[model samples]
Target: MSSAVVGLLIQELPKGGMMMTRTLILGIAATIVAAPSGAFADTPAGNQQAQNTSDAREIVCRRMPPPAGTRIGPRNICRTQAEWDLLQQQNREEVERQQDASHYSRGN
Candidate 1:
C-alpha cells in the first residue's frame, strides 16, 4: 500500500476498531494488487513513489532480549528496510573506524 494511504488508515484505526481496520487494510491491499503496473507512472517521480511504497511495506522486526536469563515475554523492535540498511551501514563504518584506530594505536 502507498504510504499516504497507510497513514490515513492508521489515523482511522483508533476510532474504527479491529474489524473496520482489517476490512480497510484488505481493501487497500486488493486495490494495489489489482491496479495496472503503470498505475504509478513511467517517469522518475513515479519510480520514486513506487520505491517509497515498497519501502513502506517492508518491515524488519527483532525480538527484544529477556532480562538476566529469565524467560520473559517476547518484545519486537521493528524498522523499515531503508532504516535498517542505514543503521547497518553506520554500525559497519563505526566498527571499521574503531579497528583502524586500534591498529594505529598498536603502531601497525
Candidate 2:
C-alpha cells in the first residue's frame, strides 16, 4: 500500500488497538518505510561490504590552477584514495623509466 495510508494507520494504532497488534503493524510499517530503493541480493556479508565501500568512497581533492586559456581562477580536482595512489605509483614508474633511459644514453 501507499506510505500515506501506512502513516495514518501508525498514527491511529495507539488509540485503541492491542499492544501486540500495534507492535506488529508498527514493525511491518517500519520495514516498508526503511526498505532500500533498489533490489537487494541475498548476500548479507557482500551487501554490508558493498555498503561500507560505497560509504568510504570519499575523494582527495585539491584546488589547482586552471589549464591555459581555460580560466584565471583555480579549479577543483578530485580523486578517490585508491585512484590517487595508483596515479602516484604510475608517475613514479614513469620517472624511473625516464631516469633509466637517460642513464643508458649517457653511457653510465
Candidate 3:
C-alpha cells in the first residue's frame, strides 16, 4: 500500500486531488515492483555467452520436429517419412554441389 504526498496547495490543486495523489503513489509503487534487481545471480563471461554449444545445436535440432507435428494426413506434403527422407537427400545433394564448386574454385 502506497501512502500519498499531499502538496503545499491543498484546495487549489482541484477536486479529487486525493485520488490523483493515490494514483501517482500507486504508479511509483508499480514501477518499483517491475524494476530489475541490482544484484544478478551467477552469469557466464560475456564472450563465453556467444560460445555456448546450445546455440550451435539449435540449427540441427530445428531440422526435425515432434512426430505429432507430422501426420496430419497424405494431403500434407511432409506428413510422411518418405517426404522427410527426400527433403534430407535434396539438402545433402545441394551441400555436395556447393562443396564441389568450392573445391574447383580453389583449383584443388
Candidate 4:
C-alpha cells in the first residue's frame, strides 16, 4: 500500500486505537513482502524454459590427478558434459598420434 493510503488509514482509525493501527500496518507490510513470491509460481512457460536450459548446460565435476612428480593433491575440474566429451576425444587422438610416431621411429 502507498504511504498516502496508509496515512489515510491511520487518520481514519478511532481515537486511541494504537493496537489496531499497528496491526493494520503490519498486515499491509506482510502482504506487500509476500505477494511477489507467488507471482512467478504459476508461470509455466518461463519456468519450463529455465529448467530445460539448466538441464542442457548442467555442470559435471571431476577430480583430476596432479601433474607428474608433484606432491600436491589432485585438483577439481568442472565442465559441462559436452566439454568433457570433447576433451576425452582429443586426448585419445593425441595418444594415437604418439603411438603412430613411435611405431614409425622404430621402423616396424
TM-score of each: 0.41, 0.40, 0.28, 0.43
lDDT of 3: 0.56
- Per-residue lDDT tens digits for candidate 4, residues 14-88, read 789778786879798779978999886875788888886676588999999999999999999999876887899
Candidate 3's TM-score: 0.28
Ranking by TM-score: 4, 1, 2, 3
User: Clashes per prediction?
Assistant: 0, 0, 0, 0
Which lDDT tens digits does candidate 1 get at residues 1-108?
A: 776777676766766477777677878777887787667556687788998879866998988776776778778889988888888899999999998888765454
Candidate lDDT values, in order:
0.79, 0.75, 0.56, 0.83
- Cα displacement (angstroms), candidate 2, residue 99, comes to 0.7
Model 3, 1-108: lDDT tens digits are: 223432443334567677776567568766775564534544678856665544433433223443676763433232344445567899999999998888775454
Locate the minimum summed-lDDT window of 10 residues in model 2. 34-43
Error of 2 at 20 (Å): 60
RMSD of 4: 11.4
Per-residue lDDT of model 2, residues 1-108, tens digit only:
477876677677656656777678778877876686445635688788887677557688978887789757898889886677778899999999998888765454
The true-versus-predicted C-alpha distance at residue 64 of model 1, in Å, is 3.7
